[model samples]
Target chain A: MSKKRLPNIIAVTLMFAMILLAGCAAQPSGDLEVFSWWTAGGEAEGLEAMLEVFAEQYPDIVVINATVAGGAGVDARAVLATRMQGGDPPGSFQVHAGHELIDTYVVADQMESITFLYEEEGWLDVYPPDLIEILSYDGEIWSVPVNIHRANVLWYNAGVFTEQGLTPPTTMDDFFAVAEVLEDGGIIPLSLGESWTVVHLFETVLLGSMGPDAYSGLWNGSTDWGSSQVTQALENFDRMLDYVNEDFAALSWDQATQLVIDGTAAMNIMGDWAEGYFKAQGWTPGIEFGWVASPGSSGAFDALSDSFGLPKDAPNRDAAIAWLRVCGSKEGQDAFNPIKGSIPAHTGGNRGLYDQYLQSAMDDFASDAIVPSLMHGAAASPSWQQDIIDAVALFLGGRDVSAFQAALVAAAGDAGY
Target chain B: MRINRDRLIAFLMILPSLVAIAVFVYGFIGWTARSSVSAWEGLLPDYTFTGLTNFIDLFNTPRFQIDIRNTAIFTVLFISTCLILGLVLAVLLDQRIRGEALFRNIYLFPMAISFIVTGVVWRWLLNPATSLERLSGLNLLFHQAGLDFLISKWYTHPSFGIVAIVIPATWQMSGFTMALYLAGIRSIPEELREAARVDGANELVIYRHIVMPMLKAITLSAVIILGHTSLKIFDLVMAITQEGGQGYSADVPALNMWYTTFRALRFGEGAAIAIVILLTVAVLIVPYLVYTFRSEVEA
Candidate 1:
């Protein structure tokens, strides 16, 4: 109640308020938030290993491993869109290279050009020139690709194939012949999953049936979607669907792969991530399951890469740049791809670190013709990809081949192909 | 002067909430309407006026047509099933059975859990390959026990896939409808039923003529509630079938809006889908709202 006591009390209260305000106003200076959808199995372990290298390099930076769990970044992309549109982007986030990054983020002016970082870190020379082209738009690099996943891969149970006296098929005719044998021997010839996996299989079949040149041409306005080649691809796809498991609609990709692992299904045409799933199930690469570039897609690499980019208004700019540097470095790529069951995007990756399947993939990457994957966000924009998925879903449900082709042509026009 | 002062005080008290609703609810709806008529098709909002192009495109798309068909099938099946089951259960409970509270709570418990949970549980049960049949070898058990016909592909059947979705949706909502019917049944006067009995009316005749007619208001309320829920269904379909059945057999407008907006980044088409859903729900709700308000004023 004394005047001196009141002044002392007021001074103490004001000091506490200022301290609290300072705490609230402080920016995340030493924090780096990396947003991704790698929250399960070997993918999560690969990310954790890469983050460990980043941590060893920058001990002061507290890495916020913000993960949105969903298969194939479906949930993460929606969450990222909301956050970016709301102007509260994370420090950095994972994006697929090529049109997914360019059409969605870079074209919208939501991403910062990382060309200078590429030059400074010598990534321009390390990453392949074609990959650099895919990651660039309007003469500027947008994202740093860490790992390359081959989408066109036919994974089979090696034991089943050896016992059935069959080899991995080399052509559509070979596939049907082997499939008939497997079917006669009481095996599901091919294992397939839900709608998206069906789309993935169709894209590989397209690549195999029409060859790489025509497959790439489908996206670049050079090839007609109504061409006979596409019609033949559709016919082959329809025939191929006949050999798939009857319960394809109810299973996820991993569950479908389980049929192959358990020796019930002869083959599954899936991405290289299936290798990661196989390994996580304690199976060796060439011993338990085997992979070849999907049937006729031999001599071509149907590729998609997972990359990270800095948003325009990202918090912790320096830390995000450091994270991108780590994502692009040889150490990071080597550390990531070995466990991710993918190959390093940069050619500088140590090949000894990879397993037998990825080693073969690396060899093919060097010798084979490279093409973008339509199902994996490399060859087309998101809207175009969704349209293809819809068309494929309808086709799987017994639509005519002509109707399926017409739908693709219409969707291609909408995508400005 | 006193009345004017009191009116001013009341307006001041509710001014914040009025502003909040005006901005957050009506303002957002207006924004969505405008966006629906724009050409913002990609990731970013362009907002150039394109008239009814988005709406026309949505109508022309076969997937959207399928969505409309699926919604009609789901709404009719869901609402009628809920009503009949709810009324039957309410009538049975009205017989003054033992463990009445326990039965009531048991029926009402599913209503307390979310639709997402119900969808998940039903998804497991309905999936032939991964459900109880596969997990516990019940399919084998059935085969051994001469019940092989019982092992049928439930949700995975392409033609009747939406029917499979309807089961879970009805399971979650019929309980709430039963509560409504139960309260209506209890509120009915015993004197009316006694009078009807004195007129040589059987239990079925009394229910068909007297109790059912008396519960008209409750039935209307249930219909309105169930109608809008069916119209705006998203989480249940998403959880149950993830990305719809084999050929988008279970696709609805709300799921279409979500994928179009968030996944495909076609904001203009997404807004058009949203407007369509809103209009459908409004068609069911506005008359009921108007009737309730008019009745309140008259009362």
Candidate 2:
């Protein structure tokens, strides 16, 4: 009798497994999953603070803060892709503002346009129109940007500058003059870090040399990459590299920032996260360290943002919309951006809550000629950025500016610029 | 009836694992292979038959070319250094030295920790390259030791940066190779050495003529193991250099494949790279598999 019942047991177990799989297909309506790469330091803390605000506002909805941490969304994007492709997108996810948002999700039709949400929240008056344009594609906006990170900040050691009787340079000619004085005085004029930082520095140089409109044209295909202006920018970048430390390839962005704080180098041109790093290391911003809108790009804001988008078929539609509302709200931006070390994407943020450097960043964001940053995910597709990275990497080794420019033109062509 | 029942039960026991391997392993491999030959460029899976376009593009690309060169240099350096050092260590240990167990444990400890862990530690030791004023890590140590001339730019060096990466790879893996060789050394019967000595052969001659010859199988195993690891090196290089060191100098095929697929979102190109890596590994492994199976059958 037991032997005959064995097949029956097997059939029952198979049926149970099928039932379990079927049961998992029905997601709970009260659950909202927010996926991101913010799993460390102030960024993580800021994410939690926003979540707290979200939780207080909606107590019934259970949020799963699903984070796969790697610096700058490297691992998180990979995980997000796998989930989105497998038809299991989270309720919401953090992404860079422009092309990363557009080329990855919007084009793939993974994200639902959040234009209705923006209008419902009355965000049109709060968010700058230009920023909204960055977040939109094909006449529809998708993601709600939370914080704007400025890419063209030139950070320097205030003590070193004071002792040398020098001020921060405002133009390309002024920069080289200052750089030369510091070099002659046995100081490395600039501190550059690894490859990506070089790209960051190069972008600032490009912006400063050509000004904002021409710089913006490089991405939109209006500016010819082989133009004399681009050549001048390349020559400037090559000159800028000469002022960097000999062992720059070994340092990271933070390490390079540390060079400024340590006064081993007078300057470091990096994103505003360098300010956060300095504060973490017990240096007060605008006192121990000083920042300028990287030389020649003073009147411009080279910006990238961390934004959240609602995916199609979200598990908790209402909760996800509520989450996005918080992401774009003045209160949410105030709570998040201060700790997150970025300026608020929403212009209505409380400036009094921010520090000195951040208040200045806010001022710059409000008034400066805003342009999308290529180093971060604003101006180009992910593939185009990789091409730039590879070209820059090769150029660093070879220092062939003409070849580098040619490569840029080729890359632009490939990207359909 | 008893025999039939026993066979059925045995089959039932292995059925789960067999099915899992078939579906998850072989099935995915087949899927990857199919995607590689298709024109799937973006997030959406378009399995339109594109036929080898991605492969052609990948080969023509300069970055991939650099990666292949870097991998070749890394493999040759990593394998040779590990084998020589491992054999040397094994020989030294076989001398019945005092604290032999202690030394052996210390040697094998690095292998126990992951390549990522080893890489994170080694990254600091090798970086901040060649600056006398800001020297730190091993570079600083070399400075104090009056070996300043010995200092080079570690993994940041343009021409030989991949060679610096090999140092860490060898440090992590040579211990395993040493363990294999040590076991091989111990297994070589004392009688054979005695007979060689009795025949007027010295210690050096015994090792060269008799002992080294006896460890041929062990060496082959070590080579096969280390060769495959060197060929598909990813995590260690990633943890250390992140972007395969400056100028694609330390890049491997696996690292390139990752960026192509995930970062750049070129699924077809990425899949093509994956198949290429698989083929490279197969070139190393299939012959070994065949040899091992044949040897087992003969035994």
Collision pairs in model 1: none
What does candidate 1's lDDT look like per residue over B45-159, in tens digits?
Answer: 8899999999999999888888899899999999999999999889999999999999989988998998888887877766656333244233455656878677656556665
Best candidate, DockQ? 2
* Residue A103 in model 2: lDDT: 89
Error of 2 at A125 (Å): 2.7
The i-RMS of candidate 1 is: 1.9
- Misplaced by over 4 Å in model 2 are A1-29, B1-6
Q: What DockQ values do the models have?
A: 0.36, 0.44
Q: Per-prediction TM-score, please? A: 0.92, 0.93
Candidate 2, CAPRI quality class derived from DockQ: acceptable
lDDT accuracy of residue A369 in candidate 2 = 88
Candidate 2, A1-417: lDDT as tens digits: 689999999999999998899678543348889999998899999999988887777777798989997757878999999999999989899999999889888999888998998887899888887788788899999999999999999998999889899999989999999999999988889999887898999899999999999998998899999899999999999999999997787678998888888888999999998889999989988888889989899889999999999999987887898889889988888889888888899998898889999999999899988899997899888888888988888887778999999889899998997
Docking class of 1: acceptable
